[model samples]
Target: MKNTYITHALFMAMAASAFAVPSLAQETNAVADQADSGGLEEIVVSARRRNETVQDTPVAVTAISPSQLEASAALTIGDLQGAAPNVLITSAGTGAAAANISIRGIAFADIEKSFDPAVGVNIDGVYIGTSTGQMLDFFDIGSIEILRGPQGTLFGRNTIAGVVNIKRSRPTGEFGGKFEASYGSYDQMGLRGVLNVPVIKDVLAAKFFAFHNESDGYYKTVGTGQRRGGSNNENFGASFLFTPGDRFESLLTFDKQVQDFDPILGPLSRTGDAFAGALPAEFVDGNNTDNVYRVVAPSQQMVGTYSSPGVTNEMNLDLDVVKLTSVTAYRESDDQLRQDYSTTGLYFADRDQQYKQFSQELRASGKLFDGFDYVAGVYYFNSRYHIDQFTSVFFGAPTHQDTTGWSKSYAGFVDFNWEVMDKVRISGGGRYTYDKKKLQTAFTDPSNAGASFTGDKNSECWKKFTPKLGVDYRPNEDLMVYGSWSRGYRSGGFNGRGLTPFASALPYDPETVDAYEIGLKSEFFDRRLTLNLAAFYSDYQDIQQTTTVSVPGVALPQTIVSNAANAKIKGLEADFSAKPMDRLTVRGSVGYTDSKFKGFIVNQPVATGPTTSISRSFDFSAVDMIYAPKITASINAEYKLPLGPGDLKLNAGYRYLSRYDQQISADPALYPTALASAPTDIITVAQNDPRLRSDAQNLLDASVSYVFSLDNGLNYRLTGYVRNLLDDRGTNTSFVASNFPVYWGFATAREPRVFGVQLGVDF
Candidate 1:
């Protein structure tokens, strides 16, 4: 079946290319001239760390421009969900400002500073180390590029999946500014402004921007009628561009972001009636319902705060034949939150964390010979963090834990592209990376006077050499075919949620993937139509799996990370854009993924008595991978009409996603041995947990805008937009606790339908 699918996909792609040539020949000269005058807009990107048209780049990537963002009403990073193929981005339920990003079935959703992300998010050439503060608001953005598959050679560590490269707008050396304001549903309000000045015309320039947005949450408490989920976000930044001479240039940037919000944790326990006997009627009255917005409230309100400040400096020098570049960056973050899990106030946690990081990179790129070019670089990074947490559960007294960790990494990489033939090119590169990490932890229990202990400090290191090879064939200016093989690696780390000394000090092994891909890029009818397709297969090894497990003599379950599985993943992607008429444009994409576990072996813990437990080996290959949907597709269209001294534009989009699982340990066999057998209700509820699966979803959005200019040399635009037009609200994230009395689960709701109006002016 898999072979047939691949064959059909390739045949269709070739057939489309063949069909395009004849169609172009049949067009009349008048139609050809019309197409030449009004065709699809050209897109230029920096996917390879250099400027090139999207059709010329060999890598499989999607570039979103500022105009596209405005048409889609994309205010935050999470709004980029359906803009690319085989990519999923969402908010982490546990953290207010965190992003849970997945690419090609590889994902990481936890909010731990110690663990690294599979997908890399790079902002202006600086890689973000942690998931915290990654879901940034969009303000003065130049461009966004999503690269699919492994990019290990050029983009170094933790790029096992791919990279989301974001570039901000630079100083234009002009005296100009822009301002905007908005109001929306749920009492939402937003304001944004940007200013650019030529400090020393032709020599230096400065740019500044600020953004603020707030909303009165959509969800409401059952009895108190209070808002459950809402947020107030702000961002401020400045940039300075200096060009002392023709040979040297420098850009310095500084930014700060703040997020204050309340998260909604709805109870969806299957055994709600069982809890009714012990808790008040209001607490369990509406539990286990399909609606996600109305939930029981705890005695104390849930609140969270996240703040981050960062600075970056990039300098470039041109020596005629060689261009040298250096980038220096530093960032710091602070996060604090108080969470209520049980809804009845029986289970809750309070956490505070601080993190700091510094990095330096130097590289040189230039033409080596007549038909050859090379790029080489060396990078160094250092980061440290501390976390303090307090927890209270139904079966045990309150406990406090403190953790501290640090990591250092060094890497050297080089890449080259050589034109060996008239119409052929070969490219290859390699990277060598060395990483070291250290961790220390302490735990205390107030109920047990002598249960306090400090874990032994531990350290570990890992090293790897990854390589890539590719060949490209350009038959003509409008046609290209490419194939490549690459290897990617992710570093190892200790579990930050470990409750015991043994688990806290043990480190997991690294994860790696070997990927093979083939793709085609083409344009037809005088650049009026564009199409691209890609097929890829990967071998994943030493997979890192995080799971909750019961421990002897501990009242609550503990979380552990281990290298426990091997897998195979394969996928197909297609992207197309067309300008059928003078004022109409259409764009669409389709993505399909097939991922399966080859071997999954875990050490399952079985309770032998009230205070003792034993471990046994279990095979869980029957379980499905999380967030690996079989099919995802989207289509968007825009139409422009000339009005009285202005242009009126209308836009609409639709997205579809297949059902998939959201939890790792959802197999029935593991539940029997992993949880206690008493209360019979616990076993029944575990078998039929609704939080384990996410249903299929279909989303729709629309927007309308009008633009005009006045005699006073001013430009104005007014826009009205609606997202989630059909109001298809589904669970964004859901999970069942692993601790004792596992009869309940928690879930977070996706945003409901939102409508707003915005006005902008430029002078």
Candidate 2:
């Protein structure tokens, strides 16, 4: 069956290419005959530390233009999932500001500062140090680039999977501005505006941007009669450009973001009726029918609030033969989460965290000789992270934990490209990274208030050398094929959520990946059609896995972090686009990934007697990797109609993903709800728990827009759009734990149907 699926996918790709070639040829001929020549627009990107056309760059990347983002109404970073193949972005926990971004089936879901993200997120060449505040709300003009596979050489560390690069629009030395507003379902409202001023004409300029949006949630709390997942967010930023000379320029920017919202934690099933009176009657009943998109909660706890403020300064100097640049940045965030965990209103958890980061990078890029170009850089990063919070069940039996950590990283890298022959080029690069971190933790339980539950300070360091080598051969101006081998690395750290002293003292090791890929990029029929295909195989070592396990006598589950095992992942990805006619455009992509573990084992707590307990290991070598859907595909189409006074545009996109698991552990005991009998001393449920699995998903989005010219150098655009048009049930996060003698698991739901209308004017 697997072979059959692969064969079918390959056939589909070939068929699509075959069909596109003929259409493109016909269109080119017709255009030439009619003298109405207009080819596909070229996209410029900075994926490899240099500005180049997407088709000319030797990397697998997807660039989303500002116009496309506006048309799709991508309010946040998480809405970029279906835009690229083998990429998935989901919210972590219930906070809209926490993003779990995965590319090629690799992601780090642990919400700890010690652990760096596998996929790197950056803005204007400045890296975002933590994932807690990575889910930035979208606003203003600019572009977004998604780079697939490891980017360890040019992008530095923590890019083992890929990178998401966001570049904001800068002052263009023109006096112009724009304003936008939108209204949507559930009383949603959005407003955004930007202004640019020429302080000194060609010498200096200033730009300011701001955005605000809010919505009443779709789900309502049964008892409080209030919306459970409502959201409110706002952001503003300013930038100043100083061009003192013809060869030197500097840009300074400052921004602040604020988010206040409640997350939707839907319940699948409830048992024991422990808080029957505290929760809604229907929610307490295990037999009650489930509504995937709705919540039945009584607590309706306070909102989770997150705030971030940051500043960056970048300077560039152009010499006769080389360009020198420097980027310095600082960012800080405060996050507070207060929510009911059990959905039954039986247990509420609260957490507060503060984070600060500073980084600087110096780089130089230019040509060394004829047909030879190079880029080199040095980077320094430092960060301070703290967490202090208390958890209370039934508003009593409070448990408190206070922790703080600091990290420092330094790296130097150099990349060189040489044209060995007329149609072939060789590229090689390497980076040496040194990482160090120190942490201190304290835990206090009122039930055991008199006992000592703290750990001493701990520190660790790691050093690694990662390299990349590739060869690109261009047989013709319209076609290129490339192959490369690369090494990726990510440093490890302590688990911030560990409940026990022993667990807090133990830390995981750094992970490494060796990847090999071969790809082909081609353009046909006067560049009216473009197609790119890539196949990759990766070997992952010392994979860090996170899981929650019950202790023998502890009142709460402790988070355990360990080096799980080795794994192998192989995949194929294809992206294609064709402008069949001047008024119509078609785009599609398909991704297939197969990931499996080897010699995998997980630790579980077992009770040998009423007073004795021990840890046992379970083998799960055959288990599949979490969040790795075997098949994912998407298709998009857009058409435009020119009228006497205006232009009408219609757009639609559809995406599909296969079933996949949402957790790292594969313990058999985590599948069943309870023990088999009262006298049973040992119970093992089974692997591949159905409760932790998410069904396949299909999502459709469509939009329509009208645009026309107005008087006095003003233009207006109006658009209406719908997301999740089919209202498919989609799960984002899954949780499982042994809460006493019973094993229960819960899943979180994604957004439902959303329809809105937007209006904008440029003057």
Best by TM-score: 1
Backbone clashes in model 1, listed as residue pairs: none
Q: Candidate 1 on 233-304: residue-level lDDT in tens?
A: 877778999998999999999988888888667665544322345544544434332455777777666778
How big is the positional error of residue 36 in model 1, measured in Å on the Cα after superposition?
11
Q: Tell me each candidate's RMSD, in Å, in order.
A: 10.4, 9.8
lDDT of 2 at 47: 89
The models' CA-based lDDT, in order, is 0.78, 0.75
Worst 10 residues of 1 by lDDT: 25-34
Candidate 2 displacement at residue 245 in angstroms: 1.7
Candidate 2 lDDT, tens digit per residue, 385-490?
Answer: 8988777756667788899888999999998889999999999898899998888889888876643388888888899999999999999999999999989898
For model 2, state the Cα shift of residue 85 in Å: 0.9
Score candidate 1 by TM-score against the native: 0.91
Q: TM-score for every candidate vs. truth? A: 0.91, 0.90
lDDT for 556 in candidate 1 is 53
